[model samples]
Target: MFPTLLIVDDEQPILHSLEGLLSDEGFNVLTAPNGYECLKTIDAEHPDLVLLDIWMPGLDGIETLREIKKSHPGIPVIMISGHGTIDTAVTATKYGAFSFIEKPISIDKVIVAINNALNFRKLEEENIFLRTRMIAKNAIDGSSGPILALKQQIIAAAPTEAGILITGENGTGKELAARTIHQFSTHSESPLITVNCAAIPEALFESELFGHEKGAFEGATAKHIGRFELADGGTLFFNEIGDMNLANQGKLLQVIEEKRFCRLGGSRVLDVNVRIVAATNKDLRQEIEAGRFREDLYFRLNGVPLHMPPLRERLEDLPLLVERFTQSWCKSAESQPKSFTPEALETLANHDWPGNVRELKNLVERLLITVNKETIDLSDLPMPYRTPDVQVPADGLDELAGISDFKEAKAAFEREYIKRRLAECGNDVSATAKSLGVSKSHITKLIKP
Candidate 1:
């Protein structure tokens, strides 16, 4: 679709000329004779770009520009004037005007300015889209009780400036939880700087946290901004924060308390304004007891503690999680959709997912890649995931043989299969449905209430 442009000027001749020229230049043009009409046109049409004369009678160009910015900040406006001055241009720019062109407006210059403004708006739109997608991708998936509670906690804590500490087993999505929190926080539009506490060497911890000036150390050729400085007005996430050494922990505590630190080899102290979010799989209480972690630091960082549940605790969500992974993998690979058989899902549900959701996602991707068929069966599962099929006793088989009708015999076998599966799964209806690759209602209907 062609971009729409609104031209606002007191002079009728200028509007008529520009409207014809812009229309011929492949634009949808809307004309307004003055500032009052311009604001009305904007309210009605929501044009992509506006060209307004600076010296209009009522509401004036500067006033109209201010109103436009207040109401629709995304729309770009270019100021036009017959008697332009540096002061006027600066004022227009201060009020968020995209560009300023003097009167006897050159059509070429107007078109160029219009194109640049539109491109800038397009880039801004794309950035908003990408950020939204990033947030969705990092969102924690599952409707289990534990997951719902975690989500509520995140929502409550995210808008505040308080510190957050996320604790969970490895691969339980600690980092993912941090990203989701930051994306929802007040500083969502700002940077989220991450520092892996366990990865940095002991000697360089201060330099890494408080930055370093040139000639600070042997390899410090130029000044370097540390994670704290980079995350100003945003967030600083520390991964494996429990692994930080005792010596560095003291320095960290002082900085957190003081909110100011001097860069290495620099005497001037820089004040920091950053929200802190840390995650660890280790139990901080145990570490503190062992004298490895500082008790004070733990209390400081644990303002709003959140725990991510391990996958085995939410087995009822497995089928949904599996389907989500399958769809994601299929879309990325540009391949045909794949699904797991009921028996295969049951086998997966039985396994103790020590590695949590991450492990399950990895296994799903591996299966989709290796299993060529659209329907992945239990036999396709690797040795560790597979389980023995239900076997019928000879007497039970004889009883089935007594049913002469094929439909009756089939129904008898299905009932027996579901009963044995249910027993094996400790009578979990959800697990039974997953294993059978059928709805829970289907399984419930076959079983005696």
Candidate 2:
């Protein structure tokens, strides 16, 4: 679509000339005789760019500029004046005018101004779209409950400059939560840099966090910007923060407290404006007690703590999650989406999801690729999850009769059968938990007593 431009001037000759010139330049042009008509055209057409004459009857250029800025700040407005002065131009610029063009304006300057303004408008629109997409991906969807309440709390707290601490088991969407908070934050327009504290080598932790000057250490050839410095005017997400070395923790504390830090082997301090969001599967409280984590740093990072419940706690949402994953996978893979039979869904929901949402998503993708059936059924499940071994014997026993409480007996037998299978799986908690369709923590709790 051609970009739209609105030209406003009391002089009929100037308006006709501008309309013809802009139209010849491949722009969709709308001409108005005065500021009042210009605003009305703006409301009606929502033009991408505006050319307003400074000396108009009734609502003048300055007043019209204020109204346009208040209503549609993104629309670029260039001021035109026949009796142009430095003071008038400065006033127009202060009131958010894109540029000022004097009367008997050069056609080339007018075209250039309109083109630049339209380009800026495009960029602003794209940024808004990207932000919206990020927020949509992070939004929580489900029926009302504690999960809904938690989502609301996160949204409410996201815009603040608070340092958030997110705690959850692996694959429980801790990263998603952190992103959601950052998306709605004051620093949303800024970058959100992530560092995996557990993944980084301990020897290089300081240089990584605080950066290093050229030749600061062995193999340090060039000056580098650290994650903290890069995240200035934005957010820094430290994943698995509990795994950071103790010595590095103290340095991090000083930086967080002072909002300034010097690069390694550098004398000058660099100031930063960054909000911190840290996440870890490990219990930081326990780590602190064990002297593996700093308590002072913990307090600073835990300005607002959000705990993401494991998948088992919100099992009711599993069906919806599964459908969402199935659709997502199909789109990415360019294949027809698959659906699970009621029995299959029940089996899926009953099994403990050891790896949480990540595990479930992986399984869904696996099923989409491997399972050929139009509808996944019980028999289509992998070996360990097909059915309890003891159920085979029960199937034969129904003919023998005299089993008055068969339901309770079946339940007991199934429980014991799963326990035996779990043990046979080497007590590799995650594997056993996945086979049994339960969370690793739940499996641990079961076997603990």
Candidate 3:
């Protein structure tokens, strides 16, 4: 687990001396006589750090440093020089050198600089990893055609300045879509401010959208910044925007259009630059028709439209979603991971998920916490979720009645029996076959396309 260091210098004495000293100090060291060899060694070894001399014969340190940065910017490079200047050091720093050291090299200083650069690199790597994990955590989880199309649309629209309107049913992930859009948008560095239009009181709507000065109102004890100001240079997500009253809608529309608003009891107009992303479970078109929402505001916010599909429409993604929720819950709780039996998954797939993804996540977490077993089964599900066990329901019988051929009817019944047995045994084909007193190949053949 020793860190590898690559030393690039024209002086063989310097290289040999540093190699011996560094090797004794517990570093896996590689020496290159010139810049060309340095680049080659880097490509071959991918060393953790580089020490480059400014005065090399061919392909001098500056040019080599540029090429190294262009190809492997993450590798920390410390520049060393016998004839050094402020300008040279500044130029190296501009070119992404981690540190610069004067020659008549002190091993103590070299070790200290190397340790600092490695620590810095480690922190940068950890930061990148955490950021990647954060982005993945907020990512939309599904592979259904609708979900894929929606993701593409978000990618296409996220970088632009145009406002986005996300519409979907309750628990259909409108808020999640908004957050994902913000995460991918150009203004990702800034905070994504969320305002629940339905939850905000009408009396304080203006104050919430635009800041109020100290003593502006009875409860205003100090200066308060509003959501719009907080969202400047970032995204402002209006959840359930369709539920915003007409009075508040007009005020919002004004700020969005003018890009400037004055705070309550403050005369100074603050110009703001914010990407607007709005979401609602209710149909805005219907709301506009019924005079509950403003048509002007709808047009302003609907520069781009995105829709989240309900869970029932993407039933094929249920298993993946279940796994994501299960792993997330298990990780957060520091508990042993649990899995769903195929029968349990089948029962879940059968139910029309009225509450969509949120409901499914809640159900999975509840089962993990409540059901004590590792494998969730069909019988683990409550009534209404598990498909009824009645022998050939009247509707199913009527459908089968159309197939008058005896062989066809027998094949249909056999297929259903095989499917049921497969689910019961958690889709373990061999286990299903053993239980049915049939060979594994026979079960596989029966289920093959």
lDDT of 1 by residue, 1-449 (tens): 99999999999999999999999999999999988888889999999999999998878999999999999999999999999999999999999999999978889998999999999999999999998999889988989999999999999999998899999998899999999999999998899999999899999898888999999999999998988899988999999999999999999989889998899999998999888999999999999999999999999999999999999999988998999999999999999999998978988999899999999999999878755558887756876776555322343556887899999999998898777667756798886676557899989999985
lDDT of 3 at 145: 96
Please provide, for model 2 over 249-306, each residue's C-alpha lDDT reduced to its tens digit, 9 standing for 90 to 100: 9988999999999999899989999999999999999999999999999999999999
Name the top lDDT candidate.
Answer: 1
Q: Rank the candidates by TM-score, best first.
A: 2, 3, 1
lDDT of 3 by residue, 1-449 (tens): 99999999999999999999999999999999999999999999999999999999989999999999999999999999999999999999999999999989999999999999999999999977876887897899989999999999999999898999999989989988888888888998788999998898999999999989998989999999999999999999999998898888999999999999999989999999999999988888899999999999999999999989999999999999999999999999998989998877977998898999988988898777655557877655766676677223343445666788999988877777677668767798876776566888987877888
What global local distance difference test value does model 3 have?
A: 0.90
lDDT, candidates in the order shown: 0.90, 0.84, 0.90
Model 3: how far residue 330 lies from native, Å:
3.9
Model 1 spans with C-alpha error above 4 angstroms: 24-26, 34-46, 53-73, 79-109, 211-225, 387-449
Each prediction's total of clashing residue pairs, residues at least 3 apart in sequence or on different chains, is 3, 3, 0
Which ranges in model 2 have alpha carbons more than 4 Å from their true place? 383-449
TM-score of each: 0.75, 0.83, 0.75
How many backbone overlaps does candidate 1 show?
A: 3
TM-score of model 3 (CA atoms): 0.75
